[model samples]
Structure formats: C-alpha cells, structure tokens
Target chain A: GAGVSQSPSNKVTEKGKDVELRCDPISGHTALYWYRQSLGQGLEFLIYFQGNSAPDKSGLPSDRFSAERTGGSVSTLTIQRTQQEDSAVYLCASSPESNGFPNRGETQYFGPGTRLLVL
Target chain B: GESVGLHLPTLSVQEGDNSIINCAYSNSASDYFIWYKQESGKGPQFIIDIRSNMDKRQGQRVTVLLNKTVKHLSLQIAATQPGDSAVYFCAERGGLDMRFGAGTRLTVKP
Candidate 1:
C-alpha cells in the first residue's frame, strides 16, 4: 500500500560537499532505480538494483556518483564532490519483479523525489 | 546508444478536446514503452504502458499506441480536462536499459 518514498524532500548543500539521498521502496518490490531530472529536462537514468544482483552503475554520469541498496530494500545514492550541474530532482522508483525477467513490462512506482540543490 | 525524443515540446488543447503526444525512440530493440505524467514539483506518475507485442492498449481515458515499425509511440487522452495539464514523458525499455524522452508539456485551456 505505501508507495515508494524518499527522505529529505529538499537538500541544499555547498559544491564539493558530499550528499546522500535515501529511498524506501514499496513492500515486496525487489527492483529499484534512481533517476535525475534537471530543470525542464527528461529523466536521466542513474543506477538500478535488482534483488541481490550487482547493481547497474553504467548510468552513473561519473565516478563521483554512486549508489547502493542495502538488504535488498532501501537504497542510497551518494554524490561525492557535488557540482552545480548535479542540482536536480532525484527520483526513485520500484517495481515488483525480483527475477528481472518480468521487469520488461512492469510499471515502476515513483516517489515524491528529493530535490537537491548544489550551491 | 539509445535515445527517446518527443516531436513537440508543448501542446495546448481546449477542455473536453482530445490530446495526443508523440514520441520517437532510436532503439529498435526496445520491447516495452510507458507513458508517465508529471505535474510541477512532483515525481512522474505512470499513465499507461504497452508491450512490443501489442500495438495498442487502453486505460480508463488514456490510450497508448506503439508503432514498432517506425519506432514511434503515442499517448492519447480522451476529453482532456484541466487536471490533465502536466508534462508527459515516454520511456522505452530494452533489456535492463530504459531511456526517457524529453517531456511534452500539456496545457489544457478552459
């Protein structure tokens, strides 16, 4: 019943500081994804976690961006040495597919998102 | 490399009229497509989705049409309402990679 949720609805941090954004996926959702939305832009894929498998980090824009899912539930996206370009809405989504096979057509439930502003 | 794009950046339709948003994806291998509606200051909300096997799928008042032959997708809203005003995005998925199109802003004029 509870949809995906993120913490720290708004975060403002100085450039070069590290910030961590948290996401709580829906119950029974084993697939989680992170995306970034710039002002008036489309969603940019960041990372994805599926069950216990190694996370997909190909979408990470740079080495400064990293994410981890703990115990297959909550995920944290950490940005090291944040830049002004990193300022955007960080959105997390989850789906009910665990094996990744059924994920092809599964609908992803999104959270309210955490707005990160890098000064 | 995969990229999804929208033909129009904005669309304005009168209340009670129909609205259609178009998207084109470069990845022909994409097997799934989804439409999402995002209001200001909110995360995207799933509107509807269609698999590659199906050419069309209908929801309450929304319909998603996929033309795999041309790698094109469209979302049609019947009897557009003021509440339907928002940014609509189309996403294409192939395997574990998903790409989202630049959103189309829909403004319903009363």
Candidate 2:
C-alpha cells in the first residue's frame, strides 16, 4: 500500500516568495494532518482535517501559514512571504479514524516530508 | 504556553541494553499520549500510544508508561539495537491539538 506522500522532496525559495507544499494522504484515510519540524527540533503540529468538518489551524505559527485539503484526500500547505525561520521540513500524516481529535488514540502514518529552505 | 518536553536531549546506550527516555507534559487535560521515532531525513513514525485510563502499554520491543499523577511519560526499549538509534518524541493530545516534545536523540552502540 502507498503511504502518505509529499511533493518536491526539497525546495528553496526567496524570503519574500510564496511556496506551496503538497501532500497525498493514504487511500481511505479520513483524517489528515500537517506538521513542521525545524532543525534540531521536534515535530510541530500545523493543521488537521477530518472528513467534511472545518480544518483545525490552531497550531499554525502565524497568519502566513495556511492549508487546504481538497476532496478529502490531497492537502496543500501554502506559506506566504516565507522567512528564514520557516525553513524546515513539512510533514503530512493521515489516520483512518473519522474524527481526528485527541483521546481517539489513532495511529497516524507520516509522509517522507518536504524539506523547504527559505533563502 | 503549554508544551511537552523531554528531560534529556540525548541518550547513549549499548546494544542489548534497555533504554528508557522520559518526557514531561503540562497539559493535564490530555488523555492520550504517543511515542514516535524519527530517523534522519524521515518523518516521525508512530511507535506506540497509551490512553490516560491505562498506566502502561507494550509493543513488540517497546513499552509506553504514562504517569498522569506526575504528568510524565516514558518509553522503554528492550535489548536496544543499532537500528533503534533515532530521535524519539513524546506527544500528548489535548482537545484537538497534539503537542510534541523537543525530542531525545537515542544512540545505540553495537
């Protein structure tokens, strides 16, 4: 079976440029999540989408960060006006659970991640 | 801001030895905790998880112990091997958010 997949394994962009990272969740996975991992840091939650419900963007670091999942499968994370601080790996994960929230204890399968560097 | 954190930044253990990594979380409302392993140039892979109702859970060669009373969590690896070397992170689920610790680098010397 195909695991979660991300596009453009590596990307380098100017600080003020906008960049988009794509994610393809596993088949039949109802819950998809986006996370960021800075150098020498842990994974930071970014956003989550479950079924048709509204996406959770609480973990997004700033207004420059946003994501959208289309047709309940593919997700795109767009960063406006990239900053050096935004240079990190963007990872996507998906679970089979219908509700992607706490207490459910669902196992999330993660993608290889898209490494972005803001110059 | 509330956050999950680990006590140690790194741990070095000999192969065949038991390795334990500890983490501390501040979100008391969290009911589920998970352990993840991340190898270089890879995304985090789920290792195990434990719910608040249970104090401990075991996997093939891993065990997750959750101590709600102390807001602590630990992952123990039995007979650690070189392949087990990676960065380990502990995460706590709060409401709709899941917070991850800074991560502890584990090195297993063969």
Candidate 2: stretches off by over 4 Å: A99-105, B1-8
Q: What is the TM-score of chain B alone in each candidate?
A: 0.92, 0.92
lDDT of 2 by residue, B1-110 (tens): 12334343889999999999999999899988889999989888999999899999999999999889989999999999999999998888887667778788899998
TM-scores of the models, in the given order? Answer: 0.92, 0.90
* C-alpha positional error of residue B74 in candidate 1 after TM-score superposition, expressed in Å: 0.8
TM-score of the A-chain for all models = 0.93, 0.91
Question: Could you give candidate 1's per-residue lDDT for residues B33-80 as a string of tens digits?
Answer: 899999988889999999899999999999999988888899999999
Q: Indicate the TM-score of model 2.
A: 0.90
Candidate 1: list runs displaced more than 4 Å: A98-105, B1-8
**A34-96, model 1: which lDDT tens digit per residue?**
999887778888888887454577789999998888888998999999999999999999988
Q: DockQ of each model against the real complex?
A: 0.48, 0.46
Among all candidates shown, the one with the greatest TM-score = 1
- Clashing pairs for model 2 are none
CAPRI quality band, candidate 1? acceptable
